[model samples]
Target: MIKITEKSECCGCNACVQRCPKQCISMKEDEQGFLYPFVDTTSCIDCGLCEKVCPILNPFDTKEPLQVLAAKNKNEDQRLKSSSGGTFILLAEHIIKQGGVVFGARFDTNWEVEHCYAETIEELEPLMRSKYVQSKIGNTYKEAEQFLKDGRLVMFVGTSCQIAGLKRFLRKEYDNLLAVDFICHGVPSPGIWRKYLEEIKSSRSEAAGKNTVLSLSLKSVPVITGINFREKQQGGYGWKKYGFVVQAKSPSKGDKNSVLLSSIFNENIFMKGFLANLYLRPSCYKCKAKNGSANSDITIADFWGIQKSHPEFDDDKGVSVVFIHTCKGKGIIKELSSRLDLIDSNLKEATLPNPVYFRSCQEPKKYSLFWNIYKKTKSVHEAVNAATKLTFIDVIKIFLRRFYNKLRRTFKMVN
Candidate 1:
């Protein structure tokens, strides 16, 4: 019963697909590699359930958070492995200890991200850190609903739009369900992610020369064993200057040395393209879940400007900016206080350096240009360079803008 005339009308959350009792709606990928709902008109019974469960059509009202705080896990090793303050792991662990399930995004064997649930603390490892790609929500909503109906405590964490979709699909709220989201900086296309991985494998094979088994056969292609979007082991900047890392093993039967590839956030081709807003879904530019519209109980993100406001808490390791949106969220924070190093903070300071918390990322000027070049060259690196490289005029404009802002700030300080 739902119609998507424009790509921006849908967030590709897969809510409609699961909500349809007739199972008549299927998600089909477009040329841009983003999924859109395709209803089987002949089979659809017009139950109108699909329309009723669309987050975009029935968005929650924007509300201010009840509490804002800076928090980090007390466990240093866990913090190191996490993308931010490692707060999510603690939260997930708490739920698991209570014999509950935690749902989150994790990479599959093929390195594709998907929504999955974990019941044990050990199972929560894959759900840690960030995947950046828009994960396929394959029957996760239905699974979560089943768990909720079974009276099991459940914690669901994902991008805000995903949380919104799940909430919409469920319709009625469950007391035992805890919905958590992040300050999302638009999800990139999974199609582009697959392309980028292929590019990496091909380039690595060429770099290794003739003796490498990677060039032998399609089956001997290197298997990506691990991928870290926010590798915190960078020598100088620690968590603040996280790196992208990919680890792989050649299928040579005997050779076991793993190849490790890494790059800083700015230098990584895929990260560059993602940060520049080159290949994000069209709906990302006009996100319906911005400004607390997802109605999540708790939201978490990197405390980007913690050094300026709480320098003592900024040990160069990651810190989380947490927004408690409801009484349920506050209760959880209290329950976890002993395990977290919590520092009181205000929302204005928390959101100051993290604009994605309130506003969606604008599409880059070279968004179309990047796709055009990629379509022709099939090179992620080339496409990213074409989209992100600044010209002389652009550099000049950046300098002038910075100078103007500095001058205004100085004037206000003097007054």
Candidate 2:
């Protein structure tokens, strides 16, 4: 049986739970809203399968990428809808066209992120974009294994830890399996996410001159129809400084779309807390799968410093920095070359702008303080504000930084 002595030891990948032949291991959410495996000692056979399949205990060796390149989907509309360069959609479509399945993180009806599989191109929409919250990987490892066993092509896209988990669970390699991981910047608490949505609904109701008290009731509250964590269509900023958008149907408007909340990523309250490293999963602070340790076929991430590195490629649209690790990854990229505008790039430039590619984020000093406040008030806003409130000097520094960045961009454009 496996035991989680420290929270950081578990990545909530659900591999141990699925690997347990006795089915004694269960994933339970902790106070921080991250899942950790719990073993039922009575039912556990002590076969040690759980420990055998743990990615953290037995991580893969880091390997140098075969090819590093910057790529963009040729389809302009698809590129705009995606959080990055829409490379994921291309990969998923490729697998689906080959009569395969694609597993990825997507939102449930209540907006809680979960790992699910899509079999067709139409089913791939929900799997697109970025869900910053840690997704519930409910038996996805087992599901993917089944598809692979059936000799069907299976593509699994998730954080590095998740890809590691799936590979560990399978115990062997599969020619039909394509594991794609991303440059992850920690996953935030789902509990905080739920609270944030409720707060947004309450605030919107009060603004609409409706009774805020009624918002407490699920039936009376407006239904959230859509949520885009990385809405790239901000007026001037576009993909460079994407917005966070939430759309809902108002009950008073007879289920019509009435509430649309939009804010730049930096301005959004939830995003502010997330980016500040307030309430990310414990494992995120000490990720063992960073820097190609997950042994994924391919890794994709936003080309954050594309403007500085490849000025001509910076169209204010999205660009993806792709690291092809295995020959399988190279083959797929070659197949999809016609559909993407590919540019040869080096790993140094990619990692320079995105340090999360190799290193885990430092745990914020106010991490404990934020949880303490949340425990008392149960308010995501109050906890985040209290924990991350900037001093007068901090505000001035931030303003100066933004001004400097703006001026530099302007100079680059003129040159």
Candidate 3:
């Protein structure tokens, strides 16, 4: 009975699939590579569980956070590896030390982002950093609930819709569960991601002057080691100017090559398309998971505009704006007080620049045009480039950056 007539009504949280009692619900990927629930008509029980658990249809009540603050991990190494402040790692580590399970998104060997769980400190490293694409939630909520039932502490981190789905799936609150949601700027289609990989592999094979069977079959695509969209490279980690660095494992058997794609966020095709809202899911344009209503125990996001209010905290590395929504969240922060540099801050001021926190993003006017190009060419790069256009000033800034870097190197050599 729970069918998605409109994509905007479904967040694609996969709760219906995992919560089906008859096991008749299956998640089928659409042309855009986003999974939606499909029920077998022959096995129609009409129990209404799916509809009841739908977060969008049956919303829950939530309260404003008790307090908000700006903080960063004292560990420099952790901070550098993180997209923003290392707040996620510190919180995850606390749960792991308490013998808890942590669930979040991570890129697998095939460079696909999916939700997975980790119980050890070592297992949590790959789970860190930001994966821009919408992650496939594959029965992770069921697993997290079981962990909570077993009297084990659980820390689940994801987008707001994801946390809402988990809460609905549990049907009740668990004292040991800590739900953490981030300020999401919408998710790009996984189809675009696959196409991007195909282009990269095809280009690489052509450059090598020979195509292997694996490359031809699209089986041996280069393994993505890491992806950083908010890289702190271009002078500082300011929101206006940031780097997109992607690291890939070498295709050759023993070559340990680190492929770095460092550029301003605007120059990167994927970032440009993403920021332009060219390929976001329809649900994102009218998201129901804003204004602290998702009931997440805690919320963490990049402390954008940190330099203006908290100059001392702005080290160009990263800083996190954290909101403690529940008493449990406050307790956890209190426990990690010594391990972090915390400063009390106004919630309104801290979240001023983050539009996603207050409102949904408007679809770009050229969204259809971009997708039309993608439909015809089947090229992620070509489609995104066609959809988004860089201004003349942006091009000039890019050129000046390259020239400055070259001049700096030359001067160093002369000295």
Candidate 4:
């Protein structure tokens, strides 16, 4: 009879909700619509299975670090369309083509990040673009597992946290289930992401002569181009850098939806205040998914190293860094080889920049100081201006620092 009071410690892992044989424990949404788990005291059997399976009270240790083909900025159509690399979509397409279900994020009616099932390539198209928010997972894994049990292939793509949570929930490995998790920065809360989009659309409306399509991308801006990824090498774990411009192209222009969401909410999304809009549960900040071993079949990120190494690559064209985690992952890459225009080269030699913004551990707090300054004001327009005014000098200074450190490291290894 584990009474879950407010005083009792809970990690919000949802294990108790799943393990309860009575199905008493369920997710309860607060006024803000943030889902939190609660127990139905009347149905309590006191079996303690909930206590045993709780990842919050008893977190699992990362098995071991395994990495391969660290790439950043892989140039390809799918990579360009993806948030980082084109791998997720490629993997999803293959699974869906085989009559499997692909699960990922898509914008809901309110433009909030919500998980959806993609049964066709057209369904996957909308999901291809990165939502940059912690997408609502509405029994997606539970439903996918049922499909997997039906002897159908199911491919699920999301942040490391989502993948970890799904694997934790499923417990047993199913051959039909293919799990692909992003090598990601933390996801922004859906509420914050929605707010950011609202502000972005409002501003973009002001920018465009009239309002029309809700679209945004980082492609036009050169300063804010590089995507991040994990790069484990022969010597040790390090960063692999790649640069690509994410062009924010809207299908149509609208009075209310022209501004870039990332540009507007860039401050909060990067991290600030008591509850940074971008964080998942508090534990995600100290994620066990940090060094891989996240139970993901394939781990992928933006191939950041490509732009410099493969100078011929068009920045807007897109690039992705793919990591093959298991046999399935290797198979995915092998399959993609035909579809993707790839060049086999060690990322460090090919495109590893001097310093990476997100992957490298040497520098702390990857975001610009604008995040703190924007927190001083609540106006989303002001935040957009601040982001717009972010001088090239400031970005260059940070990039230069990272560059010099990388140069030093490269020299040491080369000598």
In model 2, where do residues sit more than 4 Å from their true spots? Answer: 204-220, 234-237, 392-415
Q: Write down the lDDT that model 2 would get.
A: 0.88
Per-model RMSD to reference:
2.9, 4.1, 7.7, 8.9
lDDT of 4 at 349: 44
Best by TM-score: 1
How accurate locally is residue 371 in candidate 2, as Cα lDDT from 0 to 100?
92
Indicate whether candidate 1 or candidate 3 has the larger TM-score.
1
TM-score to true structure, per model: 0.94, 0.92, 0.87, 0.66
Error of 3 at 74 (Å): 0.9
lDDT tens digits by residue: candidate 2, 13-42 = 889999999888888878877778889899
lDDT (tens digit, per residue) of candidate 1 on 125-226: 999999999999999999999999999999999889999999999999899999999999999998898988887776633224432333434556667888
Q: Estimate the lDDT of model 3.
A: 0.83
- What TM-score does prediction 2 earn? 0.92
Q: After aligning candidate 3 to the native by TM-score, how far in Å is the CA of 218 from where it should be? A: 12
CA lDDT of 42 in candidate 3? 91
In candidate 1 the C-alpha lDDT for residue 391 amounts to 96
Which runs in model 1 stand beyond 4 Å of their true positions? 204-220, 234-237, 252-254, 257-259, 409-415
lDDT of each: 0.88, 0.88, 0.83, 0.55
